[model samples]
Target: MSAPRLRRVAVLVLDGAKPLDVGIPAQVFSTRGSMPYEVRVCGAAPGLVAGGDGLSYHVAHGLEALEWAESVFVPGYRHPDRDDPPPAVVDALCAAHARGARLAAISTGAFALAATGLLDGRRATTHWHYTRALAAKYPKVRVDENVLFVDEGRMLTSAGAASGIDLCLHVLRGDLGVAASNHTARRLVAAPYRSGGQAQYVPRSLPEPVGERFAATREWALHRLDGPLTVRTLARHAAVSPRTFSRRFVEDTGYTPMQWVLRARVDLARELLERSGHSVERIAAETGLGTGANLRAHFQQILGTTPSEYRRTFAKGE
Candidate 1:
């Protein structure tokens, strides 16, 4: 059979856009040509769109790009506090969304999506720093900064900066499959996956001192999910007392030590289920969830589905 058609992606660039937000879907989706996506940069009227830090990007397409796109991505912009996308942009977004085009807004791009009322009464997110503003500005929209991304069917939103990559990879995983998404991730030198429900903010407000060791500890944990880990053990690794570690860990990462570990194990289990032919019990043991029973329970609690169901949803070829 001939190769399947590539999906068209329109990256909507606004003034004061962040380069990474626009670059992410382009790079992550098209990097390996495994599940290649056709990425086009478009703007309100097309020409020169300003980016962060006095940089300017040229756009060869305009609003017309949305007409043929299978998905549209709104990159983060700097003026989310007050700026609104021109009426034309909002109207096109609504039309495209109504026609079943998947819509994703990165960081403050959610502000534009919210302005169009597309996210009304739907759970969504933006940069953690502006989630409050988003909630206040659009009371009907449920803003959740805690998640890396919110997959509300056709409309999606992601937290600040790097989370855009997470959302893009999710789209790839759902549209393509495990092996394809993993290929893209490997080409980009990024972690294979981060689940959408992963926490975006700390469990509590953090002091500067606690912030220093927080990320290092989490990176350390990501490599050790297959091992037995406890809050006390994590405390030892961080050189803090158990109580201090628990408090600081929650304050800095928004997840308890056990909660974080559970998510990590479940996420790893998902990848293995998608990529490998291993039995659920074997996968569970490998990911350190102890048994298939435990894995099923955690998947139900954290992911709202069973392991077998998840495997069926994302396993192997699409």
Candidate 2:
């Protein structure tokens, strides 16, 4: 009947840190009775620190915060091309990594991580504007400007500010599973999932009026996930041809209709496994996965675990 220990997270705010990047993980992993995370904001040394855009931060912890953290986030800062993070900060980050703590960076924070040499020969990225500088400065790092983020297992890096949300959600999903991550995203009003491989900058075209219309279709689909749902069915509900629906749906949500439906079903199954005591067969039927055998196959392929295993790890009151 007791809950698991909270996941401790630390936000390391370097000098000239961007406000949004610093705030993203702090708020996302906030321990204010809503999530299973405990967040601490720290600086190179606890005190006043200059931030980007004329803002300043007063952190309550210093590098010592990273000592006991399970995960440490390095938020992007200004002028990464010119200024290097304090040597002590870099050393502390290295020590944290050696202690098996997960280290993630946002935007130009990748620069600090790279300086620690942990990112050497590893794929990473930063804000598109600074990708060249990152590559030039840290030639050992395989700079990838195209991706929204890179998940090199424990070492993660994301593109500019907004993608920090994507990275945090990605980490949350890995730690607690899809159900908990989706709940957090809904609370934050952020997109539930965006694959790290997704492009950081999606090319834009002229505005289309049909964008908002598909949201209704998505909501409609969520309610009928246990029923027969297909691109044709969804397109019909949206009053569009399947071809148009498929094209526009990908543009709007970065997923084909069927792909989205399958992921949604998986998410629903995860919630059911965590919160209910139903049999796998019943859960499969309820989530429209049809049979226990079929559900296990999909669970292994998508979640890398069996339904029973997932339940054992995340089920409530176990």
Candidate 3:
């Protein structure tokens, strides 16, 4: 009756590191009974490293920390487009990869990962602002600017600081299974699983024409997801005509009101599949999809997997 050994994770702090980027992995993989990870915050050298947004980091370990780590995270730094990472830092990252440690980059950290030449043949992403620069600087790397993150097996990259959470949760799910990852996400108050392939940004009209106009209606719909809901019903709640509601709702959320409702239902179905043992038929009824066949079709179209298959992959106590 011994406890499981913890995985070693190192957050490699580079000069001009972004604070949120450094904090994401350090927080997600922090050692605790609930999380089976031991985090070490290290720098290029054991000293103060300048940071972005007027912050800084001081570490107790240097590149040596990567030697013992099972995973090494490179947090984004400022002005990555201005210069290459230090040669020794790049070498250390390459060596870590050579030794079978997973390497992940957040935001502009992709610049440093690319500098090591390990991402030459891999698909990667960075904060949208830097995607073109990242591609121009490293022609050999396949830079996909649209995704929230990309998992190229040993090397992973995320679009921005927030997506770093999605990346870490992804890694956690792989190591501990969906149930555990979901529990951790609940603790972090984050979304349980946002597919890495999901777009980093969605088109939304700015200055939101329907701002707050239908916020209450949306909230109302969420609570009544299992019940019959329609454009007319939602419009009634919003005190508007159906035609006006449909037009403005699309402009507001970048989705027809029905499209928004369907996505919400699918998201609810996913949660139920992971946490509950209800049969697909029951889940379909509860999510307003009406029948098992309908649920399967929607799940296939939206998540690329059937409800039963999703349950098998992510259901609790499986």
Cα lDDT of model 3 by residue, 1-318, tens digit:
999899999999999999999999999998899888999999989989989899988899999999999999999999999978889999999999999999999999999999999999899999877887999999999998667789999999998899899999999999899988898899889988653233313221122334667899998998999999999999999999999999989878778888888988887888888899888899999999999999888776665557776667577885
Query: Per-candidate RMSD vs. true structure?
Result: 10.3, 12.8, 10.2
TM-score (all chains, Cα) for each model: 0.63, 0.62, 0.64
Clashes of each: 2, 0, 0
Q: lDDT of each structure?
A: 0.82, 0.86, 0.86
For model 1, the local distance difference test gives 0.82
lDDT of 2 at 63: 98
lDDT of 1 at 260: 74
Candidate 1 vs candidate 2: the TM-score winner is: 1
1-318, model 1: which lDDT tens digit per residue? Answer: 887688888999989999988889877756334665788889987899989867779999999999989999999999797888889999999989888899999888999999899899999999877877898889999987677889999999998888887888788889989887787788778778654343313322222333556677777987888888998888888888999999887877567888878877877888887888899899989989999899888876666567776667578874
* CA RMSD (A), model 3: 10.2
Global CA lDDT of candidate 3, please? 0.86
